[model samples]
Target chain A: MNTAAALSIGVFLFTYALIISERVHRTVAALFGAAVIVALKVVPWERLPEYLDLGTLLLLISMMIIVNIAKESGLFEYLAIKTAKLAKGSPMRVLILFSVVTAVVSSVLDNVTTVLLLTPMLLYITRLMGVNPVPYLLAEIFASNIGGTATLIGDPPNIMIASAAKLSFLEFLSNMGPIAAVDLVLTVGIIYLAYRGSITVSEGERRGIEAAIENLDENEVIRDRELFRKSVAVILGVIAFFFIHDRLELPPAVVAMAGASVLLIWSGVEPTEVLEKVEWTAIFFFAGLFIIVGALVETGVIDGVAQWLLGYVSDTGQALVIVTWFSAVASAIVDNIPLTAAMIPLIKAMGSSMNVYPLWWALSLGACLGGNGTAIGASANVVVIGIADREGIRITFLDFLKVGAVIMVLTVAAGMGILWLRYVGV
Target chain B: MSIFRSLIDRKFRSIAGDRYDEIVKRYREFLLLPEEFVLPEVESILIPLDRFSGDFHGVLDVLEAYRGAKVRLVYLLDAQTFRLIEETLGEEEAQKLLQVERERGKRLVEALKESLEGFGLEVQAEERFGDKGDDVIEMASEYDLLVISRSFGSEVTKTSPISPVVLKVVQHVLVPVIVY
Candidate 1:
């Protein structure tokens, strides 16, 4: 490209890089970049609305509303307490409980919420048993990300991807659900190796903890009875609607918006409060990023990059390896949502006839697995970190990346192999 | 302070002090960068602070969004105010204050997060208690960003709006302090 176009994209990258390095406020960064692109007329200011991605926004808003109400009802604490009781005192038991609890919570709610609620409890529970909460915390974080993969609602990236790609809940279930289930089992296995020493249990402490957990049940945490009852039904109904949205020919966003509205009307949750929970900064960031990416697309920069990569990895055999590996690494550095979106059209263009469906599955695996690559790789990682800080256990970037690298590689390999066999007759 | 307590405090202060320098550095960097930014693949964050001056969640909400992509937040508390609030307001009243704080904090964070994430950033929130604001500065750099609330300073001088301790934090630590 010419110097001016190159200069604009470079400016965008530098700004994004600064953000990646956390040298700025994300919303401000996004807005700045967007304003520049608009003002400079790189992609023309008129094209902004086309990039809104409203489907993604509506789903996120609805889910945020749903989760906010659920938290109000003390749904997360209830799950955590119940999981601890089920696990008793054995470290292995703790891992099992944490994995299950985190996964389930993340699936219906979001990974961030799951970690926010469970990580502290994990820290407190582990410390109470005289063990380091780090390893368990990591496992819970990984498990939450994995578990959230089973359904579209589990993670925001996935939700955005599903909505943007027009994939149904069943599509997510069919492709991601199996991978997530298998990934969890493998994760639980590896964690068994990671924390073998801490999993041991004494009979007395185990029962004592279990009995204590039973006493302070969710009812104790949730004081509002009617609100609680209303939320339970809404959460359940939303999930059911998501699952059946495809069969009914309904877009997931429609279902989400409807669910959010019902929640507002039935539960007496103020619309203002619900709107407040929408995470506007995140929304603006997405809009700005879209414009930035659109700026690249408009200038044919992404197309150029896509063409170069497309030529190198055209063989089905080579393409699979490259896509999986690149996805894992690329997702680790860049937020996977944008990265995945940029790639979809490119992958289809290059291997239009090679059954890109499996490749899509590979991207899913890579994006999800890659998220474990760093503390910033996925929402699940951030959520648990937030909770861990509350308990005084500090997990640095290097500290988390060290373990995250291993999990990403192992799960991506395992997920790729599973899909290969099913689709390609490995 | 007893000898054992003194040793723990000294070690904690060292950690927190170091953390404070890093926190200031991050905030400075955050303020300086161009507005169109994308954070690193953030997963877990570690913030070590001594004590906060109350308005804990409000302060946390601002610093927390800058926490790389996909956040796991860790807050180091002073345990002093943790107890004070528990005692003065008693467990029930303190919890009520905390509950209100959590709700408001959630709203604000959600707003901030949406704005930030809209630019491709993810955030996770966390907290802990130790002694005071002085105690967490040492460990501030260990996190993506360190935030010390004014609650830490409030313990020593209840009459003052912003205590000398908080001023020291702003002056000394390299991190950011959302003082109210």
Candidate 2:
């Protein structure tokens, strides 16, 4: 390898090591790596913007602001309490309702935010019902990953893929949505069966929980009715805009940004407060990651990897399975964001030889669903586990792996099958 | 000579500004304080209850020893719990949950007060919202004796260690403590 190629590869691997070992914060590690590459003249400083996908960054920021504002209205808490009340103290029903809501919400919002808002309330509800929250928390973790797979904007990897491929929101939904729904059902079912004994409540305990839940006033939880109304309206309008944004020749980021701006103005919330809620670390992490990955592309390293990957496969179908399983396992071990970041360019390089459209779905499915493989696999998994730990309900890595790995394998297999049938034909 | 001294003082003040004043205030407040050695007779007793774990009944006999003493029952809604909630949701939601927990704490204090009143001791109840150990320590000086449960800050089993809050209160409070 040339000096530039070797240096970029070394910096990338070293940065990845730091992130995986968690010796340094991932953002700091990524930025450090990016800085080393630029400082060494491996990737020029001025060309940094060429690699940073503003669409993905903008979409992430806009959605975070919107969710932050909406949360202030107490909408998520209200929904959670309402869902628990709807369950009427049945443990199984609560599990189902919570899992479904988690999935549906995750498909629209980011998984981390979805889990952050829901997990605490889930813990509270389960504690009240006198049921073990482990099963419910596990279900939500899996469901969030599965649900995030259904839409382009849902998962970070999918957002990166959509922005790169110029895929529309409807395109992602139509392709990944069905399989995500199927996986959600299957995962929740397995969880319920596996933990049925622990989640089950006695008759008297059920009656007591029912009485307690009755006293929980969901309406009282809504902090601002006017803001809530405005938020719901803007969010719905944003989603609707996402549906036809392609027809209007608008990028997903534009739609999301417009919605965030309107909500910021309409809700009369302090912009600084709402902006502070944005995940700036993730944004900067993405920026640095793009530059690092861009170094690979600039050094022709991605082309070499693509050629090596193509040497094994004859057609897109075989490549689909390879990409799906490979991405899944790789993402299970590493953060899916960086994995997707590196894979996007590789897929583009491979697009030169074959119809690589199906490969996007494969990458999306594999990367998004693969996050369920371990407790540390996805941001959502880490977040929920952190919250659970703080609440004195420990979910160890192995404990999560035993369940998350199985669900991940099942979901990825289903996604591969759906992609095969849809694109590769029976 | 006085004018020269004033000029020097003005220069020092300009250089140090608020930090100098803060240090002076702290020095006056802490370093110059008189030492207190006398222990007051047990005329008023304070009992800080943990909503989930403290054993109020275990201290009844201790209270009965000071039969006619005034007992003040305080239930503090744990700010730590709401802080955890805030980490997930925002501050506004955590505040709302704190309000709910405060109401619950009030009811608990009232029920404890009613039961203590039945024992013929003059009891006053107050609900607070803050760190349990810190709040108790702050209020400990006002009362002659403090009766706290072994599991003051956390839910515990027989094998569990004494709560950190209990340890802190024991080490820091000036009053005599009865850990039930």
Candidate 3:
């Protein structure tokens, strides 16, 4: 290997270690790695923008801003209360309804944000009904990952794939949406059956909880009705634009940015206030990762790996399975964002020798769904688990893995089957 | 006294010119009058209760010490708990939960008032939302004595340390306190 390739690989592996070990903040580790690469001239400073993938960054930032502003309007809380009330205090019904809402919301928003907004309220409702929240929380975690798989912008990995592969929103929805829907239903059903005994409440307690929920006023949760109306209108408009952005010859990033800008002005919210809430750490982490991964691409390390993989597995269907299962297991061990970041270039390099379109679907399915395999597998899992811990409800790593590993295997297998039928035709 | 001291200090500053600060420092204790300390004649009593506090009946014997003292029963709806909810959920959900807690606090205070009044003591009740320790300390100044349970701020077992809120009130409040 050349000096630059060795240096790039060293920096990338070291940074990946730091991120997974959480010895230092992931953002700091990534930025430090990116800095080392640029300082050493592994990837020239001038070409940094080339690897940054401005579309993915912009899309992430815009969605964050939109979600932050929308959250202030009390829309998410309103939806949660409304859903809980709709369940009418039935633990099984509540579990199913919340899981479905979490999936649909996570598909539209990001999984971490969706869970952060929903879990506390879910805890409150379950506590009121005198049922365990662990099963519900687990179901939502699986549902969020599954739901986030359905759209181009649903999960960070999917967003990165769409940006790199130049796949349109409609393509992602049509390809991954069906499998995600199926997985969500199956995961929710499995969770309900597995934890039904724990979630079950007596008839008297159910009736009392029903009365309590009935007394809750969903409308009272809306802090600003006008802002709520504007946010909903803009979000709906954004979704509509996402569907037809391809026809309009616009990228998903542009659609998202336009929506975010319009909402900022239309809502009359201070720019700094909304901007302050943006997850800059995640954004910078992505920027640094792009540069780090770009170094591997520039040094031809990825190309060598791709060549080796192609020589080892000449059959396209077998390659699809390898990529899918590998992405799933690897994502389960580390943050999917970095895992997907490293894989994007390798997959692109392999595309030259064979049809790699199905590889993209496999990567998305494996990386996104694989996050459910462990407690530390995804940002959403860590966030929900942390929230649960703070409330004195311990969801140990083993407890999560027992359920998460099974769901990850099931969902990834389902995704693999769908990909095989769609692209492999067998 | 403060106003009079300020006038005297100004006059002294004019006479002593730049030497005023040095003179005040040398005789600071004499210059600043010492506050008079007197035994508190307990007439009005402030009792702060959280949901986990022991029943008022457990403290009735203590209350009988200050016979005919007006009792103010204040139920504290802990702001910290609601803030945690807000941090995890959104502000709207926290507000809704706070409102529910406030209503529950009101009901608790009202029930306690009726029972306390039955003992031939005047009783007034109010519900407040704030940090339990800070609120108890702040409210204790209005009454001659503070009556709080050892489990005022949090649930405790016999082996647990005294409640932090009760400890804080004991340390800071100028009024006499009865920690039952």
Highest TM-score scorer: 3
lDDT of 2 by residue, A1-426 (tens): 999999989998999898777677788999999999999999887888888899999999999899989978878777877888899888988999999999999999888778866776677678777678899999998999999999988999999999999999999999999999889889988897789799888889888777777767778767799999999999999999999999999999999999999999999999998897677878989999999999999999999999998898779999999899999999898889889998999999999988999999999999999989987677777766766664677777678889988899988998899889999999
Q: Write the per-residue lDDT of candidate 1 for residues A1-426, one digit (tens) a residue.
A: 775479567856876775665556566777788788888888776777766667777787778877776666655555666676677666678888788778877777766656666765676567556677788888998898788777777776677667656778888888888888888888888777876776766788776656544544445655467877788888788888888998999989899888878988998877787677666766777777777766776777766776787666665666777778888898887667656655665565555446566676676677767888887677566555654553466777778878788888888888888777777775
What TM-score, to 2 decimals, does candidate 2 have? 0.72
Runs off by more than 4 Å, candidate 2: B1-180
Candidate 2: which pairs clash?
A: none
TM-score of chain A, every prediction, order shown: 0.91, 0.97, 0.98
Name model 3 segments beyond 4 Å from true.
B1-180
lDDT of 3 by residue, A31-114 (tens): 999999999999988888899999999999999999989988879878888898999989998998999899989989989778
Q: Which scores greater on lDDT, model 2 or model 3?
A: 3
Candidate 1 chain A: worst-modelled 10 consecutive residues by lDDT:
A210-219
For each candidate, report what fraction of the true interface contacts it reproduces: 0.00, 0.00, 0.00
lDDT digits (tens) for residues B36-128 of candidate 2:
223447889898876665546766665766767899888877777887989999999998887777777777787778777777789988777
TM-score of chain A of 1: 0.91
TM-score quality measure for candidate 3: 0.74
* Candidate number with the higher TM-score (1 or 2): 2
RMSD, every candidate, angstroms: 19.6, 17.8, 19.2
Model 3, CA-based lDDT: 0.85
Q: Give lDDT tens digits, candidate 3, residues B1-180.
A: 344233323332322233223322322221111122235578898989888677667777666666687998888888778889999999999989877777777777887787777777799887777889888888888998888888888877677768776777799998878788
